[model samples]
Target: MANRWIRPEVYPLFAAVGVVVGICGMQLVRNICINPDVRVSKEKRSSAVLENSAEGERYAEHALRKFVRNKKPQIMPSVNTFFSDSNRD
Candidate 1:
């Protein structure tokens, strides 16, 4: 009689467990490695730049308005002649 190490049915279960464990471990490592100090510094800088200066706020607003205006589609009239003398008094 030959000794079999792994049953065929258990192989898929092991693979599934391995995949779940790997994903969990990767997420744990990423959470641990992320720098909170860098995030805080970036947030402070952004808020300071955006909220501190009136000129900067004006520039940002102007830029945003310009961007929105530029993104709008231009509507051209399909009719060639503007003046249609149909009901002239």
Candidate 2:
């Protein structure tokens, strides 16, 4: 008699599934980050460009403050929270 539960063929199937999932995740990240227009509206893009042209640092600081103020009270945390916490830790 031999053990029947540990199938040798299962390893390859799991590996293939993992690769597929990784590829899909990479595609999603690429789409989101590499293409800002996908997520940004026209008004937002115009404002960002205007802000970046004349006083870039000041604009960035103001934008950051506004973003933090708007999102701090929301139920879900913003992406900056993750970045800020990671840098501090």
Candidate 3:
């Protein structure tokens, strides 16, 4: 009586049908959720530097020069010199 529910011979067929149905359902859901109309377009923005006048440019340049002068130069050791004792010095 327990075996009468789904015949053993038809098990593979049912599995195949279930797989196909699941794939189709997933595709349908994806299409519905990921439609082009559902996406929001981002607006293009302009930079403050682009909108500045001549006087603003001079002030910005002066600030940048001061910043550059205050920052210490970074020395990175060469990778090839890592193994050689003489090259490291």
Task: Give the Å shift of residue 23 in candidate 1.
Answer: 0.5
The C-alpha TM-scores of every prediction are 0.35, 0.38, 0.36
Tens digits of per-residue lDDT for model 1, 22-86: 99998677545542222245455454333335644553466458776755353543342344445
Which residues of candidate 3, in runs, are more than 4 Å off?
37-89
Residue 18's lDDT in candidate 2: 100
What lDDT would each prediction earn against the true structure? Answer: 0.56, 0.62, 0.60
For model 2, how does the per-residue alpha-carbon lDDT over 13-87 read when each residue is reduced to its tens digit? 889999999999987886666443344565666544342344444434564596777555656566657766866
Candidate 1 regions exceeding 4 Å error are 1-5, 35-89
Whole-model lDDT, candidate 2?
A: 0.62
lDDT winner between candidates 2 and 3: 2
- Span of 10 residues, lowest total lDDT, candidate 1: 31-40
Model 3, 4-45: lDDT tens digits are 877889999999999999999987775555433332333312
In candidate 1, how many clashes are counted? 0
Which has the greatest lDDT? 2
Model 2, poorest ten-residue lDDT window?
47-56
Instruction: Report lDDT (Cα) of residue 77, candidate 1.
Output: 38
